[model samples]
Structure formats: C-alpha cells, structure tokens
Target: MNILAIESSCDDTSAAVLAPTGVLSNVIASQSIHIKFGGVVPELASRAHQTTISQTVAQALDESKLTLDAIDLVAVTQGPGLMGSLLVGLCFAKGLALANHIPLVGVNHMDAHIYANFIDESPSFPFICLTVSGGHTQLVHVKAPFEHEILGSTRDDAAGEAFDKIGKILGLSYPAGPVMDKLSKEGDAKFHKFPQALLKEGLDFSFSGLKTSALYYTQAKEDAWVQEHLNDICASVSEAITEVLIKKLKRAVQQTGVETIAIAGGVSANSMLRAKAKKMADTMSLNLHIPKLSYCTDNAAMIAITGKMKAELGEYADMNMKPFASL
Candidate 1:
C-alpha cells in the first residue's frame, strides 16, 4: 500500500510517501523564522504549515515518483502537539483523502516516535522502548506491534526540555538540543557537576530540578567566566542529562528483564546519548535499537508507518476524528 503522510505538529512541516516496504521519500520543511524569537510561535507555526504543506507534499510525491492518485491511504498526526499545527495537517489530509477516495488514518505523535524504530530494522515484539523528545520522556513496553504499555515517564519537564532551558540560559536560540550537543563535544564532560533527579521509587523522571540548577549555576558565574567557559558549561550540562537518562534506562532494563531495548524521538539523535546507550547495552548484554537521524525528529514517514501498522490491526479513524492538543 502507498501512504501519503503529513506532519505539522510543531515548527516542522513535513510530508512523506511510504510504500508497504518502507519510506520512499521523507521531506521536511523547517521554519527558521522562529530562530529570532528563540522559540516557536504557535500562530506563526500554523501559518507556515498552511503555506508549506502543499509544496512539501508535492515534493514528497515527486521525489517518490508517485502521484496523489496512487496513495492508498492518507495518514496524519492527530494529537499531543500544537492544536493549530495539528489542525493544518489533519484538515489537509482529510481533504486529500476525500478527493482521492482513500482511507484516512489519524496517528498519535508520540506513537509515531515509537514506530520509527521499525522504519529500517525489524525489531521483535515485547521489547522495552525509551522515547525521549522535546515534549515527552517515556519508557514503554511494546507487547505487540501496535500495543504498548507506559512503564515510566517524566513528572515535570522532559529531558529535551531541560537541554533547551539550559541552552536559553546560555543565550542559545530555539531548538537548542542539537546546538548544545555540538558544543559539548568540544569541552570536558566532567567540568561541572549538575544534580541528577532520581525519583524515589518508580521509573518516572524529573528534569525540572536539573534545569533549575543549571539556571542558577550559570547565573552565579562571572560574566567573563561564563563567556569563556560556555562550551564547558554546555558539555557539563549535557553530560549530566545523559547520565541521568542512562542510569534510569539501565534500571528499567534490569527491572523489566527486557533485553531488547529501543530509543526514539528527537533526543535519540543526540550523539552522546547514542554513544552512552550503546555502551550500556553492550555492558548489560542487551540489544539496542535506535532509529536513523532522519527518523529521529518529527516527520511523516513515522506517522505513515505507524498508521499502516494500526490499520493492519483493524484500527481506523473516521471523518469525525478531532485533533487534540494533548494526549
């Protein structure tokens, strides 16, 4: 089956064509206008989607050498994102589906991140998945292809949120995770020590305190010192965040006895996180599944693949389906 997918849950306007086998073309159009603002502006993001969706979809189809008429299913992200951004994709998808007389599938943004691991590799069922993104941090047990159980998650801000907050305190722009990751590679990881929030009992995480600590730590630095040690600060902060995540993930693996583990979402693209995860997986004698960088961030290929999996299980959303702001 050929699926046409749209993703506009945030600042990225993405579209893709996926065959039954895998992704044919995944095209993402990012909005750089938010760079100056240091964060995403919801209204502006919506407008950018409206302007870019058609062209983006067209590019995907063209690159895949397919036409809208060839699309057997139209899939779109439905929730856990900006409402305006969601609506733009949802409405566009609905219109396309209606015009082409194809099946329309509504996909959850978070769920898509989990399915991203399946894009290139065949992961067995009953594995543990750690999904860490800008908006979410969760440990899920994948009992089946489409069935999942949330074992743990963040109680406050997510891990990626902490990175962004720390970046802002250091005068970085919006979407700071990648920037921080790049800067961190040039400095010493042990330069500074930040507190790691280890919740008492469960696998749940808390990054709010860590973010606050970074804020205060940076504020106390002399202006000259901060300017000179910016790279060290970034390296130290990223190292602390990675350590916390790796520690909790190791605990989850040991407790659940799940040997096959996967990491998903935007944060999964972090080089340090990937290196540490690989090391831990090796030490624990477990298999680790991490998606390609292109599949890590928000994109439509993941949504299309997820919808296809759900559709195979007799899951479908009707025209009455409504977009949600949160899960």
Candidate 2:
C-alpha cells in the first residue's frame, strides 16, 4: 500500500510517500523567518505551514512519481507540537482520508522519531531509544513494536533547548545546535568544565543548569575574549551535554540489560553525541541504530513509516480525531 504522510510539528512543513519498497520521496519546506527573532515565533510558524503544506505535499507526491489516486493510506503527526501547526497538517490529512476513504493513522510526533530508525533498517525489539530533541529528551524502553515504556526524561530544559538558548547567549543563530556542533570540531571539549546535572543517579536529564552556567560564564568574559573563544566554549558545552547523555545511557543499559540501542530526534544529529554513542556501542558490543540526518528532524517519512507499522495491527483513527498540543 502506498502511504502518504504529513508533518507540520513546528517550523517545518514536510510530506512524504512510503511504498512497499521503502520511502519513495520526502519533501520539506523550512521557515527561515524565525532566524532574526532568535527563536521560532509560533504564529509565524503556523502561518508558514499553512502557506507551504500544500506545495510541500504536492512536491512529495510529484517526486514519488505517483498521484493522489495511488495513495492508499494517510498519516499525520497529531501531537506534542505547536497546536496551530499540527492542526493544519491533521486537518489536511483528515480531509484527504475522508475524500478518498483511506485509512488514517494519527502518529505521535515523538513516536515518529523512534520509528525513524526503522525507515532505513530494522532494529530488534527490547531495545532502548534515547530521543533528544528541542522539546524533549527521554530514554524509552521499547519492549516490542508499539509497546513503549519511558524510562526517564528531562526534568527541565531539554538538551537541544540548552544548546539554542546558550547559543543565543554566545551570539549564534536561532537554531544553534548545528553551528555549535560544527565549531565544536575545531575547539577543545576540555577547554573548561561545564556542569553535568543529575549524572550520578537515574536516567533523568537536566540541561537547565548547564545553560545557566554558560550564561554566567560568558557574562564574566570580555566581549573580545568571548568572541575569540567561541569555538572552545561550544565544544565544552557539547562535551558536558553529550557526556551526561551517554552516561545515563550506560546506566540504562546496565540497569535494563538491553543490548540494542538507538538515538533519534534532532539532537541525535549532533556530531559529539553520535561519536560518544558509537564509542559506547562499540565498547559494549551492542548493536546501535542511528537514522540518516534527514530523518533526525521533523519529517513526514518517519510519520508514514510509523503509520505503516500501526496499519499492520489495524490501528486507525476516525474522523473525530483531533490535533493536540501535547500527547
């Protein structure tokens, strides 16, 4: 069956087509207006989605070399995102399903991240997934397909939030995670120690303290010095964050005895985090799964793949389904 999916979880408007062979085409239109604001403005993001979603979906279908008539199933992100943005995608999907009599699957945005790893390759069940994104961070124990137990999550600011908020303090772009990762390569992780919160205990993450430290640390520095040492500062921050994540992951592995591992969501695209996770997986002799960078962020292919999984079990949403801000 050909599955058509929509994703408008935040600032990105994306659509995709998934076929038996694999993902056929995935398309995205990103909003760049938020760069000057140093953060995504919800109203602007939703408006952008409204403007681009149709074109985005059409492009996806065009690239897939299929028309709407070939789409047998419809999937859309339903929750844990900007409500207005989510509504645009969900309503569009609902309309398509209603018109075509296609089965509809309302996918959780976070669940899509976990399943993103499944799009390209299948990782065995009973594995742990470390999902780190701008809005959330969690260690989820997937006992089997569609059966998940969230072991732990962020008590405060998520890792990606810390990166962007701190990056703003350091005079970087709105989404500073990518730029920070790039600069980190040239700097020293040991340039200066940044605090790793709640590292001695459970799997819960806390990046709020690290953001505060970066603020105070930079505030104490002369403007020129701060500018001069930007790379080193970014590296140090990445070090602190990635260290805590990997350490918690290690503890999770030891506590749960799960051998297979995976990382998903935007922060999973971080170079340092990937490196550390790889080293950990190698040292422990465990299988590790990481999605292609394109799958790391909000995208419809992940949603469609997750929808296909649900379809296997005859899980379908009705016309009464509605988009949610959190789920």
Candidate 3:
C-alpha cells in the first residue's frame, strides 16, 4: 500500500510517501520569504504553498519511485493552522483522492506530531507526550492508538512563541528559535535568571509573562550590551522556558504515574530541552522517545504515517470534509 500525504499547515510546504515498512520519501520546500518580516505572513504563506505544493508532491512521489496511480491513499492536514495554507493542501489532496479514486484521510496537525514518534519508534501505551511548538504547547496522555487526553496546555504564549518573540527582541533573525538554540549552546544558562510563569500552577502553562519580562529587561539594556551577551541571554531564556516545561512534565508523570514518556512538535528539537528530557528520563528510569529533527517540525511524513494508521482502522474522510483553523 502506498500513502501520499501533504502538510502545509504553516510556512513550509511538504509532501511524503509512506510505504508499509516506513516512510519511503519525505520532501520539504521551506518558504524563505518570511525571513525579512521576522515572522510568518499568512497571505504570503498561503501564496507560497500554492506555488510549491504541486512540485513538492511530485518530488515526493519521484523520490519514492511511485506514480500517482500507485498511491492507494491520500492524506492531508485538515487544520489547527493557517486557514489559507490548510486549504491549499486540502484542495490538492482531495483532488488526488478524487482523481485516483483513492481513500482520503484528514489528519489533525497536532495528532500528526504525536504520531511522528511512532514513525521511528513504538512507545509503550499510556505514555505522556509533551508537545511544544510555535503555535501550541501541550501535555497529552496517550492511552492507546488515536486515543489521547490533553493534560495541560499553554494559556497564553507557547514556549516556542516565547523563544521567537524574545529572540526578536535580541535582534535575531525570523524564526529565531533555532538561531537562539544554537547560540545558547556556547553560553552560561545562569547568566541572567528569567521568570518562570505559573510554576506552582497545575499542568497549564503561561509564557506571556516571560515574554513581557524579557521585553522589559531588554528594553532597559543597550543594544551593544544585548548583542555582546547574546549567547548568555539566549541561554538564560532557554533555561527559563525549558525549566517550566520540564517541571510540568515531571508533575504530569507524578500525577499520571506513566513510566514511558516522549516529546513532540517543533520545539522538541531544542537542544537544551532534548538534553534535559534525556537526563530526566535516565534519572527517573523512564523510557523516552523523541522524533528526529526532521519529524520534530511540521512535515508530511508524520501526516503520512498518521494517515496510514487511520486507514488501518477504516477511518476515511469524504469530499465534504472541510479544514479547520483551531486546535
């Protein structure tokens, strides 16, 4: 069986082919246009998706050594993302399914992130997943295949959002999360302590306060000083954000008593967060699973694999299905 999937939930336009054993081919075409804006522009993102979607899918199929007729299932991200971007992917996917007479599966963007861990590994049932990304930060308890209960989520800014927003204050490039993470590796995480919001609160998170604090802190400093201490400042910001995430994960483990755990979504690729998760897993004698860097972000492979899972359960979406923009 061949499953072709498309993911255009945000900036990048990606497509993938999933063979029975695993992903046969994964192709991504990222939009560099948003760099100057220092953030994603919805109109630009949708236009980019429309421009790249066809070529991207063709490349994925070509890489997989499969023709459009060979694909048996078509999957697409249905929502919890930019509406225009989601529509671009969905329209393409629906066309493929209709033209080929193949089955269609519309997957949730967040659900695909969790299933990304499944692509490389099979974590035990009832594990905990801490999914942190630019648009969302959530802790989920996965009891079984396709069965999940959200334990907690960000009430304000997500962890990744905080990273990028704070990075912008530091005069970093757009999509500053990766830049900051790289810079943080060489600096001291204790250089300046940033506040951890809702530390004692339940599983819910709040990074808005942290962002505000960073804004004020940087506003008071000279641009020269901030640039000189860029690495240290990034490290300190990372420390503050990750500390809270780890704390919440620990609390979730204590409350749920789940011995198996994992992290997913874009921010799961953070070096500091990954290292901290590893240490915690080792210290707690827990089985830990994390997706490779490719799978950590929005990609079609996760959507493909998730579509395959749904196909196995006889789940299918009809042509009447529509894309949504909320989680």
Supply the TM-score for candidate 3.
0.99
Give candidate 1 misplaced runs (Cα > 4 Å): none
Instruction: Please report the TM-score between candidate 2 and the true structure.
Output: 0.99
In model 2, which runs have C-alpha deviations exceeding 4 angstroms? Answer: none
- Per-residue accuracy of model 3 over 187-288 as CA lDDT, tens digit each: 899999999988999999999998899999999999899889999999999999999999999999999999999999999999999999999999999999
1-327: candidate 1 lDDT, tens digit per residue: 899889999999999999976789999999999888888899999999999999999999999999887888888999989999999999999988888789988999999999999888888777898999999999999988767888899999998988887898888888899999999999889998888887446788998988889888878888789879888989998888888888888888888788799999999999999999999999989988999999999999999899888788878787898999996
Clash list (residue pairs), candidate 1? none
Full-model lDDT for every candidate: 0.90, 0.95, 0.95
Per-model TM against the reference: 0.97, 0.99, 0.99
lDDT for 275 in candidate 3 is 96
Better of 1 and 2 by TM-score: 2
lDDT for residue 23 in candidate 2, whole number 0-100? 93
